[model samples]
Target: MNKCYIDGSIGQCGHSSRSADKAAASGTVMDLKKDFHMNSGAGDNSYARNSKIQGLIISKSQSERRKAAVAAYLGTGRPATMSVADLGCSSGPTALLAVEDIMVAVERACVELHGQPPEFNLLLNDLYGNDFNALFRSFPEFNSRRQGKGLCFVTGVPGTFYGRLFAAKSLHLVCSSSSLHWLSQMPEELQQKEGSPAACVNKGKVFISAGSPPCVAEAYRKQFHRDFTTFLRCRAEEIVRGGLMVLAFMSRKNREAALMEDRYIWGLLEDALNAMASEERIDSFDAPFYAPSMEELEEEIGGEGSFCIRSSDQFLVRWDDDNQYSGTGGEANVTARPVKHAVRMAKGVRAVAESMLRSHFGEGFGMDDLFCRYGGLLAQYYADSEAAVTNVVISLVRK
Candidate 1:
């Protein structure tokens, strides 16, 4: 059996080259449930520590999250009990933040209507390998600090949100953050085929970049469309009619996926890897990520026909948006700031991509040196201007 590293974790690779065709024949192909998860635990490179930027992105979408939760509950006639699911709830301080916020929104809505606040059945969903144990360990503190009135039963559901994970009409609200940009599997066209010289068409780059072939971008777009359509169909089956879903994920302002802001970071990594091309680090390695355009998203949602868009908007997040740097105006300070920012950036990327890197390039591939070079490259790239990442926040209602 083949293995794949997703989000810095090892898992069995159940995806085959004909995964799309197999899905058409058997109703399902790839089983991503067993793969994909952020680096677990609270170690230095753990996602728990390096995910502050993700928290900030989630914070920026608070207004929409609250509105969606309230609207979904109100539309349900303020049921005495409600079911809510937070998809892709990785282990971290921010894991329960959304759950707590949604609870508060529902309670407030119920109060306004002079009805009793409903008991909540909150399900936190993520890949099977996620550090759910750590998430559950923090639940006691989260429950104690929560400011809402009502019984909240929280359970960790280990599975992929790309497929149906809940019973029909069982969910009142579904939310996901900093996810969805990941395809269910690597694009088949980009996969390294045995004995095929042109197997790795996207050589030297971990993701879409300026030098990637036109076909590379098409494969990524198609994979995203397939995964996203499956996601919508699964959610449509689970969520009650009129229920709401608020999804926020990385996006690109440009219609072309290769021209996105964050893609530059990957491009920098590609340069660093190419510097060590003799070590073969760039051989047959591709990051299974795609930041889509608003048009692509609109097209997929429209084609899915299971949901109606309530609101859609895009926002910009700076590379150092979490205020990780504090440098006074001075030549010395200016020179030092980018280096520090680059280190932070590398840590963030490692927290999410290290497993894949290690898996693809042997364990002895000098990852430390690779990232050091990557950091320096990013520092130089950002010296000329501030870096910004685009994100799209969409709220939808089940039709």
Candidate 2:
């Protein structure tokens, strides 16, 4: 079939149209919806199990999420029916974790007003390749805990968030956590074919790293602006005027952090890959990700013009290093913790990034060796470095 829709107005599917849109690309030659899922399943190294880091990030903004949900509920006059969405909702506990936060907040508001909560139309969105089965299999436990929240209906809408997914002004509250940094597609300049004159060789790196030319970072910055603006525009159409929107994602505090500094995640991965295979031998790959600064986010929100920033916050979360977890650092560090933590962190990064890595490098490439070496590099650097990521969460309202 050429078209598919759920609950009457999800989205129409068409490849010809997709190939025609061209606002972006994912690295080189990859359909993000097809190649971009986190490692699926309930395996030991799965994203489901390795997502505690993201959960911690989400918890940091729990208060704001609730406030946004309640504001949307009240701003919409607390209608008999309410619609909310968690965009970029890759599969795992974190997916439901976000939905639960909004549900709890809105329910508490209803209780305060001595009114019955509206029917909760909770939409879960992500790329099509995501494992919705695993997400839903974990639902009974979630539903059991969700009692007294409201009559909630969950629908999985698989598509890119950079484009519109819902009908006009249909959503009351739109919340996305740990997801916005993913661009809709790779920067056009970076994706040029090998022999093409304008091709940008961000050579020997998965992302903009220590030796990347300034143009590499600039291309990424411009792409982030374009995709983020598109994201805001699409959401504005789906969310009612004055509806609340909350977003939490990885970010940087300044230019140094944005430059990869050898302490960044992707930079560390590049080191591992370079050690495994010489830099010249490494595949020509670019990751479809970017971490924007706080100022950049505010500028985009204002420039997009559809959403006004109601509030925003920036916080730091340490990498999941064992020494930090055990309160051991520098000389007192439990040497074993770093090793184990390195492997654990390696798995966590793999779960989220392996799909893109595999797609770019192909099935025959050695993933185990990559992460193993990556763990070593991570351990070495994080042992003596703060190496924390700046998470920026913004609360927005349709204008």
Candidate 1 stretches greater than 4 Å from native? 1-35, 195-198, 277-281, 327-331
lDDT tens digits, residues 1-399, model 1? 232233223334332221111112111223344545688999988999988878888888889999999999987777778899999999988898887889888888778878888899999998898899999999789878864567989878888888889999999999999988878887767765545555667766767878788888888888888889999999999999989999999998888776777787778888776665442335455677888999999999999999999998899877567665653667877776666666677778878877656555544555555666676676677678676678999999998
lDDT tens digits, residues 134-183, model 2?
A: 98888889988976556888899999998999999899999999889888
Scored against the true structure, residue 255 in model 1 reaches a CA lDDT of 87
Q: Count clashing residue pairs in model 1.
A: 0
TM-scores, in order shown? 0.87, 0.87
lDDT of 1: 0.77
